[model samples]
Each structure stands twice: as C-alpha cells, then as structure tokens.
Target: MTPHMSRKTRIAGISLAAAALVAAGITAGTAGASTVQAPTADGSPLKLSASHRAELLRDASATKAQTAKELGLGSQEKLVVKDVIKDADGTTHTRYDRTYAGLPVLGGDMVVHTAKGGAIKSTTKSTKKSVKVASLTAKIAPAAAAQSAQGTVAKSLSAKKADAQAPKKVVWAASGTPVLAYDTVVKGVKKDGTPSRMHVITDADSGKKIFQYDDIRTGKGESEFSGSVDLGTSKEGSGFTLTDADRGGHKTLNLGNSESGEGKAFTDEDDKWGTGKPDDPQTAAVDAHYGAAETWDYYKKVQGRNGIKGDGKGATSRVHYGKNYVNAFWDDDCFCMSYGDGEGDKAPLTALDVAAHEMSHGVTAATANLTYSGESGGLNEGTSDIFGTSVEFYAKNDKDPGDYLIGEKININGDGKPLRYMDKPSRDGQSKDFWDSSTGGLDPHYSSGVANHFFYLLSEGSGPKEIGGVKYDSPTKDDKKVEGIGRDKAEKIWFKALTEYMTSNTDYKAAREATVKAATDLYKAGSPEVKGVEAAWDGVAVK
Candidate 1:
C-alpha cells in the first residue's frame, strides 16, 4: 500500500476496524485505504419498488396512529410512511412522517423496520401483528451482501480460535474504570450438525449489537447490515469490518449506550460519548459520519492531517459507558472514543463539536503529549476546545449550527446554558482567558481557559463578534491590537508543535517554544506561522 502522509486517530472506540488497525501498528493517518472493493448494491434479497413503498406507507399511517394511541396519543397521530429502504446489507429500513394533533410534526425516525413486519401490518382488530418498526436506506453493492453476511455466517470457531492472549485493555466511565474483558459469542450447530456454533469476540462490557443477518427463506442467509459499529462478529483475516461499512470513504463510529436498551448511561464506565447511541446507533453512526468526514476534510482538505493524528488513520468512538456518567475523557489505552446520554429527551453529547473535541484529543495525544495538569494541561484542553469549535464551524449543520459554545444543545447543565464559551470563557460561570498556576485545580473544562483564550485570540484576534449563532466578545489585556492568523494556520502550527516538538513533560513555556518551533518548521522561522503564533498569544492577552 502507498503510505499516506498524516497522523490519524484510531477507530478503536468507534469501530473494531479502526481499533484493529491501531492494534496492528497502522496509525490512523498513515494507513492507506485497502484495495478491498465495496459490496454490491443489489447484494441482498429485500428490494422494494415505489409501489411497494407506497403500500407500506399507507399501512404505516394507520399503524403509527395505533402506536401513538398505545403511547397514550389517543387517535391523534397521523403517520405517513415517508421512506422505505432496503439497505445495502439486505436489512429493510424505513422512516415515517409523524403528525400529532394534525400539526406539522417533527422528530420522526429511520430504523431497522423489517422485524417480519408484524407492526407495519398492524390493525385494531389484530394487535398481534402490529409493530413500531422503522425502515432505513444504505448504499450497497451486489457483492457487499454476501461479503457482509460472511461475518454472521462466518466459518465456525473452536476453543483455540476463541482464545485471545493480550494485555487487558481498560475502559473508563463515570463511576469507575473497568478492565476490558473479551468474550466470544458463539451460537449455531457444531460440526456434529447438531446446533452449530458461531464464535465472535466482543468487548464483553456492553455486548452491544454490531452486525446482524436475516434468516433467508431458501438460500444461505444474506448480510443484512454492515457499517462501522461498536461491537460485532469480526475476526482476523476475514469477517465483517468497519472498513466493510465505510461507503463514503473512511468512516467513523460515535458510540453512546443509552435507551441503548433505553438510552440509559453506564454508571461505572467513563460517561464519554463515542461508541453506540442507545436510542439510535445508526443516527449516531451517520451523524459521526457527518462529523468525522467533516473533521477529516477539515484536516486533510483544510488542515492537511490524514485523520486525527495526521497519520491518515480513521478515528473510533464509544458512548454511554456508564449510567448518568455526566463526563467524557480520552487516553492512549484505546484509540477508540465514546459519549453518554443526558437526562430525559436529552441525548448523549454527539454534537459535531463534541466529536471534533474527542478526535482533537487523539490529535493532542499523538502530538504534544501535553500533561493534563497545570497551565500546560490547560493549554492542551484549550487546544481541543478551539479545534472542537473550529470543526463545528466546519460541518455547518443547520439544527446544531457551528458555534463557539460547546454542548449547547446537549443541555448538560440542565439549565439551558452551554457547557463552555470560547469568545468569553467566563460565560459558563467558570473558565478563564488568562492563566494562573491554580487553574489546574479547576475542571479541565474550566482550566482549559488560558488555551481557549489563546485559540480565540488566534482565530478572531481576541474580540467579541458573532460569526455563527452563539455570540461573545473577547478582550485583550495589554491594549494590544493583536491581529488574527485565522484557525487554518493556527491548527497547522499547534498540531505540528504538538507532534514534533512538545513532550509529555512539556510545560506552558515549552508550549510556546514548541509552537514557535512548529511555526518555524512549517513556514521558515519568521514566516506567517511564526508571526501569527506570537500575535495569536498576544491577542489571548498572554503578553
């Protein structure tokens, strides 16, 4: 494979594919795309014509109303089967347009709708057949069906095959950190032709669903669904892979275990967002696709990193580590990442910026090795904050538009206020633009101020103006009119300094020096990067 030039985040937390690559010494950005071809679009048996879709939609309207009634909506739900899809993996996916009280309603969904269609064919006279199933769509190739299905129908595994010898990987949640226990899920008839056994390794923590296949009527079962997933039936040398599901190119998985059976967070695991979404892993998956792709493009097409670490490796994510685990973090034990669900209708923190933030953490780890304490630690946190905000601006999602405020829609504070404000760090009641040694004792999210201020100054020149929705104005201390070098140049300079010059023991002064070194490396000692680094820090009121 032609070597890619970039440092990329491992996909361990997001998909077993990225995780395995990191495990195999293929850092994120450097690993070139494999020659593996995509599966065929017509690979599965489930195909729906326009007429078939309309028929299902007609039936869906009435059944959804019944569902609404069951949910106590009382004959007020007007459902429209808006979409019916046969995913590339052969799973029948569906979506519905829901109207409540005859008002133009929203918040409907796309989901695995083909559970034998018991619910889609629902009627008041027959409660046994009705279901609240949703159908979805995915890009598939003809060969993809058989290729993806191979994981589920994978050749049998013996006790020897099931055993794995390696250092135990540790995972963190809100309540505590748990050692990763790997187990094989085997189900099927043995070679004796009795009940066959199919062995698949799992994280053994959440045992989340990875890939599935529908029992075929006459032939060997087809691969029903395949995508970058949190947990699955993959094995070395063969079987389903996240790469198998990467359709739009390099993909990312954002895990959050909630309604996961109920969107409930893991109580003992690190409450970060990454793995799977309890309410909807697909939504999380696709959304991550949007965010990760954007970040990848931001770095590659924009910042020039192959992935997170600039190694060209895809990133991984995990979510809902523990119940009510109201926090998130990243580390080297696993290149994978995750998120958590908030209270009520609130979802785990899967915003574009949040994903960007976690991915940025991977970038930070691979580069600066910045100690997560004191001013340097604050700078590390600030770097993530700034990049996270930049990525938000990158994706430009309408619902969650690019903004300087982190976790605004997540409602983490439960008071409708955002988690952190970049323009003015103090907006959240705790955060700083200037640094003091004591800032380390504060929340890393809070101590992150000095760096956050630095980034703000670098991007917009330490001022207050609204670029994307959430607004704030920053001020420089020394009456210095610091000019902006912009985020594009700042990211290049910060990341380079991080990976090439900064060390684990690097401090605040070291941070400055390393950035200067990076600036020198990128643009010759006194080029734009050098001047920009000086001016950006000055705007953050550092000078």
Candidate 2:
C-alpha cells in the first residue's frame, strides 16, 4: 500500500508543523521515558525498584555442565559460554559455542534460557543437526590455506600488498557435511581506495574456498527531519569544532570529495553550525551530531543502556565521503559511522533512522555479534531497522514521527519510495514476505523482510492498519489473522531476544524461538504477548 497520499503534501505539512513548533519554542521531548518500565495491560507501568531490577538482570549462571545439560548435549559435545544476559524477571539467557571432539563447531552456537527459579525453559539452536564431525584433521596446511585465500582476494580486487591473516581451524557445517576448514582474513586496499577485508572460508581437506564475503559493509542514509538542528561543538584554539562533548564526545569530520583521508574537522567562529543544507558542509555534520545524540538518548532513557557497548564511550561520524558516493556504514574497525553524499551533494545521508540504522550495526556487533551472512545477517539488518524505527519514534520530532516505513525521508531510490516496507515487505519486489530456505541466498537487506514483516505484524498486526497517519495492508503467509502487542512491547521483546537469546549464527527458525522465549520471559507463559509472537512468526512463515 502507498504509505502517504502525497509526498509533497506530507513534506509541506511537516515543514509547517516544525515551523509552528519552533515559533512556539516548544521543547516537546520524545515519547520514550527516562526510566525502563515494562508496560502492563491497560498501559499501567510495572514498578520495579532500580536496585531490584539491577539484581534481577545481573545474575547469570553459565557453568559448562549446566549449559550442556540444558542443551541436551551428548558426552562428546562440549559447551563454552560466549555471553550471558539476564532479564528484569531474573531469567538468565546464556549463549554458548559448541565444540565437538576437539574442533570448534561453526554455526553450532545456541542459546539456553532459564526461568526465574533457574530451570531450563527453552533452547534456540542455529542448526538442529547434532554437532558431530568425522575428523578434525586437515590435509592442507594453514600456510597453504592462507596463501590460497590471499591469492583469491588479490585476484578479485586486483589489490597490492594483499596479506592473509593466519588461518584458524573451524568446522564448516552451515550446509553439507561437517568438515574441517580454515577461516582466513585477506586484507588489502581496493583500486577505489576502499579497504577490503575478505573473510575466506577454505576447506582444509581440499584447499578450496567454501565461502567468502567482503568485510567492509557498505550502505546509505540521510537527514530529513528537524529541518534546522543545533549541533553540539567543542572549543579548539580560537574556534569551535564539531565535537559533541556532551553526548559521549561524538565528533563529525569531513572526508572531502575523495573516499580516503580524514578530510577535516568542521570548525566555526561560534558554536552554532550548519544552514540545514549541503551548501554548508557542516549541515551534514549537524544531522549526524543530532542523530547520534538522539540515538544515545533513546538507548539510555528507554533501554537503560549507557552507550552502544554500555561503556559510556562515543564514536566518531564522518560525512561528505566520496563524490556522490550514495552510502553510509558503521566501521567496527574504527568504531565510527560514515556517510556519503547521495546523487548530488544535496542528499547527505544522515537521516535519523539512517544514522540509527548504521550505529545499530555497532550494537549488534557488541551484543550477539550476529555474523553478516545468511539468516543471521538478515536478522542483523532487521535488528537495525527495528531500532531505527524505534529511535525515530522515540525522538518524536515534529519533522519525523515514528512509523513502520523505513527510509521514507531519504529518497534513496530517487522515486520518493521508502527503501523497504515493513508491513508488506514484498512490496519492494526483492524482499520476501515469508521465510524460506532460499532467503539465505538473497542480500541481507532483502532477506531481512521476513523478520521485518514479523516485527511489523507483532507491532500492528495483520490486515489493514493506520499508524502515525500512514496507511498499511499486511498479509500473512498462512492467511491467519494476528493481534498486535503494541510497538512498545514488540521492541522490548526484540531487544531482549537480540541481547539475550540470539547468537552469532542465528537463523530464521532460531529467531522465531528466541523471540518467543523473550516474550515468555517478559510477559508470561501463554500470555497474549507470547501468543502474539508465535502468530507473527507464523505470519512470516517461520514455523
């Protein structure tokens, strides 16, 4: 369904509303509360003391014996706790990496959820197939594997000084038989000045490259809301620089018109910056700064998380990267977010949702560390979309309100259409409306449709719906109706599932189980929330 009646009319209305708000000098805050309070039926807040909630969320039991027993692992299977998170109800979610015989099992990680009384409740596995390999021995040496991977990457990129990191022994089990393999990283600089870090999975038995992906994740974003924003600045020498000391010291830099080099730090005579247009280089910086602040506020106030890594540290934002580059990305190597001017310098991709989307990649890296391939990659992308939508809503800016539509403000497609539709993902042509084995072959951005649809259904249910003045029509794979548990509850459940129950290699089925476990932990067993999660997953054909 078309989200808005007319893009021009909506933009004009939004501009008018923003003008009126600014004229009245109204400082309407976001819809998010300062404290974390799970909502009850009738919209009443559950009052849990801060100390009590902390106590409940901190206690985690991750003994190897306990995890093994919870996962029903055989005598030959060993478990190592990768991470642990406890919910507000004292239920602990422990993620484990599996080892068979003596080799690390790839794609064999799982999560075990425990109830308040420390009883195992449910377990989510990436692959239901048992962890067992015939042999851990490899015919090919690590040196040979590394050389082969380096050659493969060099040929692909025509790169110079291409070097492959030492190969690590791991079991290859996503498809086919479980066999020994060497995971290698071939690092080099591309002809376009972009860095390339190719993750090459080579079969140790044959020295063949089984799988590979470019480590440099690329994408795009923009800043359309809060038309004229006030950026935070820092005093340097006799001038002010675009560095936000207040919001974890997030600084914005210019990459000039080239793809390389740290261009320059935006500086001004006064603390004020930007004219809300690309004519002023600082405008993109302003949007990036505001986005970072708002996203930080959203996590801290709503989720009670201090920062991306909960370490109270900030990341840098680089803008004006490449000539009409048309993309933005979060680089874990630099712990920063970068944006490119789209088409012309007119579209600087620093929109709230875009910024939130890119930064969320960092959060996923720090939390579940979802591998950027197959179903886990799709979940990773969907998690970004979920939080990006949440952040837009949490900001509640007059220019941008919370909606299920993504990339609506940024005309990335040049047709004024949003990048993806959450309610009906198939509207994008490439995105899937339901889960299927073939989804793993699609781009993560496209394969994310199933989970995105599930989130939308969980938030607004199936069938005709209007939210934030936008129209939507959602359909289920099974033609079954779904009842929403509200976006507030849905986001909470997703966040819990992401931080608690999800592991690196979680697939669509595992995601279904994780979200169900999250709902059960937050709400109760057999509650509407739990039932809603199941129904939503069913709507996405996950079952």
Candidate 3:
C-alpha cells in the first residue's frame, strides 16, 4: 500500500469492509435527500418531514398561551415555543421557554407532551414551582452586579483582567425557590488564551452571587489527521472559496494566528485544497471545511436536523485561531466553530471528530440549552461526544475510520493517547466510568464519562470487543450484561431525548428518565429497544 493508504488504514482501523458497510448504510438513508424518513418500531413513519415540523411548530405557537395557563403559571408568565416534535402515534412534544413580565426566565424551560386528541399526556420541566416574585424591581444596581460578576471571574478563573457586560434582569428558578435576579456576563482571556465567558446570577434583593457558569465549551484537538479528503467549495470570481453552498453556505476562515475578530475567507486558485502535510495554510482549512460538511450532512441525514439551529443556515468555521493555541471551541455568540494550531503550530486541532464535537455544542445550545455547569453541564458535554463519534462513523472516511476514541489523531497529550475513551472513560484516569453522587462535581469533560459509557454499552454492549483495530473492554457497575442495540438506534434515542424531552436542569438521573421516555415514544413501552435503553443506563449505574 502507498504511504497515504497505509496511514488511512492505521487511523480508521483494520476492518475496511465493516467500516464500508456502516458508511454505506448511513449514506443510503441520507444521501441525495433533504430529509430521510425514520420509521418507528411498528414500521410507521415518524413525523419528521418538513411539512409535519412546520405544522407542529404552528400548533405549538397557537397553544403557548393555553399551555402557560394550563400549567398554572403566574399571570405575568408566558411561554414561547422553541421547538416541536411529533412521534409516529401522533404524540406531539412542544418545547417552550418561559418569560416573566417580559424578562426571560433562566431555567423555566419545559416540554409539554400531548396525545393525538390534544389531551396533555405529561410535562417535563426544569423547575416545578411557579415563577413568582414580590417585585420585578432589583434592589441591587446593574453596575454593582456587573462589578461583582467581574470579580468572580477574575477570582475563579484566575484571569489577569475581566470585563463585565450590563446585567440583565431575569427570573432565577433553576434551583430552590424562585427569585428576581440580575444575570451578568463577564468576559476575559484565560491564562491559556481560552476566552472566558462567565455567567453570574446575583440576587436582586441581597446583592449576593447566586449562580455562575462558563459559557465557553472547549475541546482539546483537529485536520492534519484525515489524510486527503473532499471539501465543499463555491466559485467566487475566477477562483473557488472554501464555502459549501449546498449545505447552508458554510465557510471556513483563516484567523492568521490572531485571537479575535472574524477571519479572512480562504480562497483557492485550482480548488484542489490541502496536502497531507500541515505547512500549507490551506491544509488545515481543507480539514476544517471537510469536517464541517460531514457534520452538517450527518445531522441533516441521520437526525433530520437542517442545521445547528434547524434553520437551514450554515455556521462559520475559523481556523488558525491564536498562535500555537492547542484547543478548539464552539462560541454561541459568534455562532461559529474556531480551531487553533496545536503546540508548535505543527498540528491543527481540526480533526473530523473534533470538528463534530465543537459543532455539536452549538446543537445543544439551540436545543435543550443545558446549563454549562454541574450534572447538566456534563450532559451537555456528553451530548457533543456522542454525536461527534456518531458523525465520525457516519462519514466512514478510510483515512479516519470511526472508532470509540475521541481526539485519537490530534495527540493532545503528546503521549499519543486520546483525550477521552467512550467504552472505558476511566482509562483517562480522571473521568468517571459510572454515575455517582460525586459525578456532578467533576469538570464537565470528565463528568461526561457517565453518559459516554452509557452510550457505548447501549451501542456495542458490555465486555471486550475489537472494531476498527482498536480494543475496548467495557465493564458494568453490577456486572450485569447489556446487549448491543446498534449505533443507529442509540443515537436516535439520544437525539430525541435532547431535542424533545430533556430540560435545562436535567442531571444524570433526569437524563436516564429522558432517554427512557424517548425510547418509549419511538419504540413503544416495554419494547426491547426500551429495555436496552434501561439496561444500558443501569450498566452505567444511572438508576
């Protein structure tokens, strides 16, 4: 085999035929289609078609006022429909964001499930109590709250300087009793050049810090990894630019080693982009561009999502961010994915899985809007890893075959080990392999292991196995065996739970409930799929 072919085999795995089959199956269902039909267990088509989605959204909007009233919310509270999903049996799940007295409620998000005849079946909420306060006025001034928020960021993040944005009045109800509060956002650069966006909630009456969480979702490694690959580009003037018009006009930009601002668009003369080497600037761009396209296709075809926001609008990818910056991140404010050159600018954190991982963060923000702290934060991170692996398998690129290992190619540790392992998360030495009382206390990345392990057991079962030339030994908490249910079903259940059932405050326990509910909706109660979901979570000690 040629050097290129040899590298491809080593990176993807040993079973070329198996990889091809997986890719072919995914392609057959999604290729050349705006939306693919997903059949429930009974062989009935789920209402994911564009027309059905539109109809569901319209119905949800029309009934928002009634839903608020039905839930016994305060007169000042109102519901705004965020997303709508319908199952095969005519059950509609409408997700909404609550607002009180025209101010957004931080954790007052919920999903209302209805039967075929418009009767409410059940409802899942982030908070149970009504959103009410003695007054909307804040005794603490916005300037004072902003100053306090900035101080927290500097002290907590150890940043040299922090700037705070004007505090916005909001209803704090994610935990404990409801209260009027000021939501302040503090911005600064961390010691490692990672941008810090700390969200601080302070009591309106007491002027005390009530809650704080960082908005930055960062991943360790990306593109000199995927050998030679195809990229979607558009012709501009006489040359082609790194933009995919077919997939929401997604474009790749060159940051030129700067730390801020929108970077310049990458343009090529012959449209033949990237070498296997990293010296060429376009090489990293090629990887980033290709990764974005593959991720877009994966969601569009596999999950029936149009884009990150489900609006058919493509997001931007910024490459070469900062000098020797060894991380990549998804910024909600920019609605873009940014990548940095690793260690010595020799390796770009633009690998396929890294791209998928960062972009998935955007998907989470647009969907459940899971708070980026504690158990919910772990779920947020885990959701990205699940989809990132799924997207890798879906791409089926021989150069980068799908494996359960994340950041395998980027060499983030310099010891040639992956950043995290899905099958056995504890291999990293810090991640938890099972859910526990202390899981929420770990960093979001490490805490995500519970969900990661659950997904691996759900898709590939427990015990020892080897696929794509990599060996994995997954163990259950109780030594109970869990049978595999295939990645397709596993990912479908997760996507459904994330988009339809899960709320902002969903923890490990809540995630278990959400996935079980999602499985029941897609495959009916007591079905093997539902059983598999339960068993998988059980194996991870979620119950």
Candidate 4:
C-alpha cells in the first residue's frame, strides 16, 4: 500500500497554514516559548529562539507577495513560506516552495536572504531560471502517463503486478529547462516483498519520461547487531508495553513476519526486554526501540531538532517486516520506520547505524525535502549517513561504537564487511570517492560517496587517524591537506545548511555553497570554520 501518496499538496498547505498561524502570533505547543541558547564555536547566535522564529515568520509572511514581485516572479507564481531563520546581526533568511499557475514546481524552491532593513541581500535557488510554462493544458491523458510510468517500473524492477495511480500534473524543473509534467506513483511489491513506490515524471505535452525515483529508501545487508541494551517502556495493566513516553511516545511493534499493515505492539510481563538473540522476537524489537530513542536524543541534543518533522511527535518502529526481507525502509505516509529480518531470519537489520540512517531520512524529508534522485538524492543519503554516524558517536555504545564505517555492525555483506565507508567510500568497490561529471548518474548510494568522503575529511582531516578503536585514512581528491574542523562544528554547519539554505534540488556544487553560507552564518566569514568547509569541499573535488 502506498502511504501518503499525495503528500506534496498536503505538505504545501500545511506549511502555509502553519506560517499564517505563526504570523498571527499563534504557534504549535511550546514552540513559541522564549528560550535562548548560547552560540557555538564562539560565533554569533545562529540558533532561532521561539519568539524569534515567530517574528521572522510574521515578517516573511507579510512580505511574501512583495518579495515575489521584487524577485521578478511571474504574476501566477506563488511562494509558500516553508521556514524562517534569523542571525543575531538581524539578517533573515526565508525558504519557500513555488507554485506556478497552481501547479507545484519541483525545483523552484529557494532561499531569500535579506539585510536588517528588509533589503534583499542575496538569494540561493535550486534553479536560477524563471518558472513559466506556456500553457497548463496536457495533450496526453493522465491514464496514458500512469500506464507509461507503470511500464517503466515493470521494466526497471521486473515486477509482475505493478499497479499505477492516476498521474498529477506538476511543473518539472528539476533538470534541463522547466516544463509541464505528470507525476505518477506506481505501487507494487519488490521481489523481496518490500513495498515499492516508484515516482516517475513524464512530460505532459509529449509524454516523455523526465525523471524517476523510489520513495522506499532502503539500507542493504543485515545482521543481529545490537547486543544487550536498556529499553524505555510504559506500564499497561499489570505488564509493560514497548512504548516510550519520554521520547514522543515512540513505540515498537511486531510484524510477526508479515509484509503489510500495522503490526501488534510488543508487551512484556516485566519491564525487562530482549535477550540479544534473533530467535526471540523481542530481541529485534529491543534493538529497534533503543535505536529510535538514541536517534531522537541525538537530534534533540546535537541538532536541536525536537523530533522528526520538528513537531515533538513520535513515530512508530515496526520490526520483522517481511519473510527474509534483508532490508529496511522509512515511509512518509505511515510516518514510521520498518525493519526486515535478514536472510534465514537469523539476522535482523536493527543495527544502530541502520536505525539512525533510516530515521534520518524522515528528518531530511521534513527539512530540505531533497528530491530522492540525482545529486540531491546522493546528498539525501549522505545526510543520513552523516547523522547516522554522528548518532552512533553520541550514543557511545561499547558494543556498537561509532566509526566512519557504516553498517559495520550489521555485517550486511555476509563477508564480515561494512555496507559503506566514509573515510574512503570506494572501499566498497561500487561507491565514488570524489565528484565528477558522471557522479549524478550513478545510484544514489554510490553517488553519496562524495559527501561521505567530504564529511570524513572535514571531521577527521586527510591522512590517517584513529578514534574509538577505529582507524581511518581519508584522502583528498586534489591531493591537498585539510585540517579538521571537529565533528561538533561540522555537524552544526551541515544542520544549518540543510535547514536554512538548501532546497529540493540542491546539487553537489550547490551543497558546497550552502555549507559555506551556513558556516559563514554560524561562524563569521573568513573564520577557520568557513575556510575549513571550503577546503573540505575542495578536498572532495566538488570545487
């Protein structure tokens, strides 16, 4: 079943309405509370306080129309405010999604930065070109587009019974020039029983395939990784349920080897749970529950994000997704994370990094909403990897110590190897270690190597180093030395970039600019941190 298949429209409306509420001095929960935190790295205050965010939103919403007109947007083009950020020096950056002639523009998202007095300072856009289509009429029927999309998915995945949903008209600007297109979602079950939600974009006028991507993001390989661990549970009747009240009521459910529907909630007579063995169903649940909590804490303490979507609401974690599924995924429709039992049901993909990796996808969806294809897709995956590694380090679990090696504990390769490496991504044989013209054409998992490598070099620097018993030897594409900026500052820069500067179609080059801008925002321009960001991108050949 395709979950939240038509979420784009809903998300757009919700964002606009939320902005309006903020503008009217009404906000969600304690989001409007006055709480200020010290700036990091001895830099200016980059953190947005509750009242500050509301004021920024109010100002942004009030000037939306004027800003669009000043930016030379078409008369029919409308801007919906998505987020607002403020600097201590009184500069404001507002992010928005564009709608042209009532149709969503895939790559028309942009960030408008203004000086203290409301004069435009600079702008960063996913596409610099204007968004205007000659006509809104589609010569091709939606049914034909859906059928064509289904055929593409069938050809790509070799599935027997792929079902197509009615295609919706959207302005496709992610690649080439802007054009009218049909966005079709095809649903089916992959060979391994994982639910498929392939998004295919076709030209509305000519019915030509434009772009496609799978919504079901997965992490390959699996192992019963998490050892004995503590779990947060709540009392129900005389027993305890695997529901964590401390962290947005996050709960773990048992799929019982099923492939569909909401699974049953795990309950125990005592508060204790799991034996660290896959034979017992509770073992996997224990890992999933613990992993979710760790990810939540990491985002809260490290990233200042209260929860996924920044709404302070918990998401469900489903364990034992399918029969020998061998993979895990996150579904926006369900707003939940699902895990599969590895081959033969002896190994589960509930490792710490895997859990953090999947959950970070939700965070990306909430913030940048990076298109899960092309360079943006690679950055999306890379973002998850970066935060997943960060969460692992923050947890500092002895059994699953943080390392640059991803999926190390899961043993997904079956040869006692990791799924990917950050220090040198090409160590996995399929990943690209540096950026090139053809990097965007590779699978996102492989293309993500560039970002993974950049983060490693930025955090640990080039050459050899050791941390927490894991050794790393990162190399620069340009054969230049880059001093480390430390992971704390590095993560902060990345979070700021992802939240404040990036848009849907931000490519590797755009990412470099966003991070530099983010570094400049958090640390003054010409600061060592800003220089370090530029050098790290250079080290990855993104320059």
**Each prediction's Cα lDDT score?**
0.43, 0.71, 0.78, 0.76
> What's the TM-score of every candidate structure?
0.49, 0.80, 0.90, 0.88
Q: Per-residue alpha-carbon lDDT of model 3 for 1-543, expressed as tens digits?
A: 211110110111111100000000011011112232354653232536456577778878888888878878888999998877666677777889999999999899999988889988899999988788899888989999999999889999899669999999999999999999999999998877788788999999999999999888887543334555666777676667787877788889999999999999887667676655567777777777777988999888877788887777899999888877777888999999888776677666676767787888999998898998899998998998888888877887765656787665444455887667888889988889999899999888889889889988988889988766778889999999999777788888899899887889999999999989888877889988899999999999989
| True lDDT of residue 142, candidate 4 | 97
Identify the runs in model 3 with alpha carbons over 4 angstroms from their true place: 1-59, 222-224
Better of 3 and 4 by TM-score: 3
- How would you encode candidate 2's per-residue C-alpha lDDT over 106-193 as one tens digit per residue? 7777777777687887776666776666677889999999999999999977986588999999887665676789989888866544
| lDDT ranking of the models | 3, 4, 2, 1
The TM-score of predicted model 2 comes to 0.80
Question: Which segments of model 2 are wrong by more than 4 Å?
Answer: 1-83, 94-137, 150-166, 171-178, 188-195, 220-223, 230-232, 258-264, 344-346
Worst 10 residues of 4 by lDDT: 18-27
Clash counts per candidate, in order, are 100, 7, 7, 0
Clashing pairs in 2: 219-328, 220-328, 221-349, 222-349, 222-350, 222-351, 223-351
| Weakest 10 consecutive residues of candidate 1 by summed lDDT | 21-30
- Candidate 1 TM-score versus the reference: 0.49
**Residues 1-543 of candidate 4: C-alpha lDDT, one tens digit per residue:** 212111100001010000000000000001111223333443243444446566767878898999999999989999988777666677777888899988999888888988889899988888978788889999999999999999999999887568999898999987788999999999988776778899999999999999998887766532424455556677776667888777778889999989888999887765666665667787778777877888998887767666786656789999888887777888888899888776777666676666777888898887788988889989988888888777767776655445677665444445777668788889989888899999999888888899988887777789887766667788898899999777777778888888878888889999999899888877778888899999999999998
Cα RMSD, model 2: 8.5
| Best model number under lDDT | 3
Query: What is the per-residue lDDT of model 1 for residues 28-47, given as tens digits with 9 covering 90 to 100?
Result: 10011122222223222233
Backbone steric clashes in candidate 4, count: 0
lDDT score at residue 242, model 3, on the 0-100 scale: 80
Clashes in candidate 2: how many? 7
